[model samples]
Target: MNKPPRKKNPTFGIAIFIVVAVLLVIATLFYNAITEKREFDRQNAPEPTISSDAAAAAATTAKPASGAAQ
Candidate 1:
């Protein structure tokens, strides 16, 4: 029987690998840049304030949800 042709060159796979690696590097750098900017903004932000009554309400509702999950 005649043998069908298979992938003879590994260059295509190597090129794909290089492209993916470059894309990943770009993504990592972009993510890091955004996080650094966010950190800077967070540090400069003013202290947040919330009502004690609302906080207590949230805390009370949280316990029953946890118990019901059991």
Candidate 2:
């Protein structure tokens, strides 16, 4: 008895892989856009700035030793 021919296409598998890769790249770009928008919105929100005196006081408080002459 003669056996029938099998249909095996290697190009089909490569095409599927290429499609999945493109989808992943698109997803990454979408996710980056969302995160950047959120971060930009947060930056635009009102935030208090530290005054020079407050910054100086914080530095003094954080010092490990007194500023005595050696």
Candidate 3:
């Protein structure tokens, strides 16, 4: 039985390697950026200014539906 002739160019393997290498590099950079951003946000996120007392008062004073029968 005769086997099929193989193509000479090794470009398929080289292309696959290059794509994987680029993907790994991009993934590393993206992960690093996301982690840094998350950490920075965690450290710098704003604190709510409303006091607990004011929040409680507002909740208690909130009105019901205006169209509802009393």
Candidate 4:
């Protein structure tokens, strides 16, 4: 006897598609957030201060040499 053909079930396929779509959307949002954060950091990064270097130079100059006595 010939067996009847199986009916295609769309429920599982639709569920998987929805899950994948949601995951993709979440991943895209996460990626966008990271990209925006990187851009913001690049734009708002602190400028290098020369005051520290100047302070170091001044300190070295102000110190008496080991060979010199006050």
Residue 7 lDDT (model 1): 65
| Location of the lowest summed lDDT over 10 successive residues in candidate 1 | 61-70
Query: lDDT of all predictions, in order shown?
Result: 0.87, 0.88, 0.92, 0.93
Candidate 3 off by > 4 Å: 1-4, 51-53, 56-70
lDDT by residue for model 3 (1-70), tens: 9999988889989999999999999999999999999999999988867796689889899597999878
**Model 1 bad stretches (over 4 Å):** 1-7, 46-70
Ranking by TM-score: 4, 3, 2, 1
Identify the candidate with maximal lDDT.
Answer: 4
Candidate 2: global Cα-lDDT? 0.88
Kindly list the per-residue Cα lDDT of model 1 for residues 1-70, writing each as its tens digit: 9989886799999999999999999999999999999999999997655786678778778455555856
Backbone clash total, candidate 2: 0
The TM-score measured for candidate 2 stands at 0.58
Q: Put the candidates in lDDT order, highest first.
A: 4, 3, 2, 1
Clashing residue pairs in candidate 4, if any?
none
TM-score for each candidate, following the candidate numbering = 0.56, 0.58, 0.60, 0.67
lDDT of 2 by residue, 1-70 (tens): 9989988999999999999999999999999999999999998986655786688788788444576554
Clashes of each: 0, 0, 0, 0
Best candidate according to TM-score: 4
In model 4, how many backbone clashes occur?
0
Candidate 1 residue-wise lDDT at 10: 90
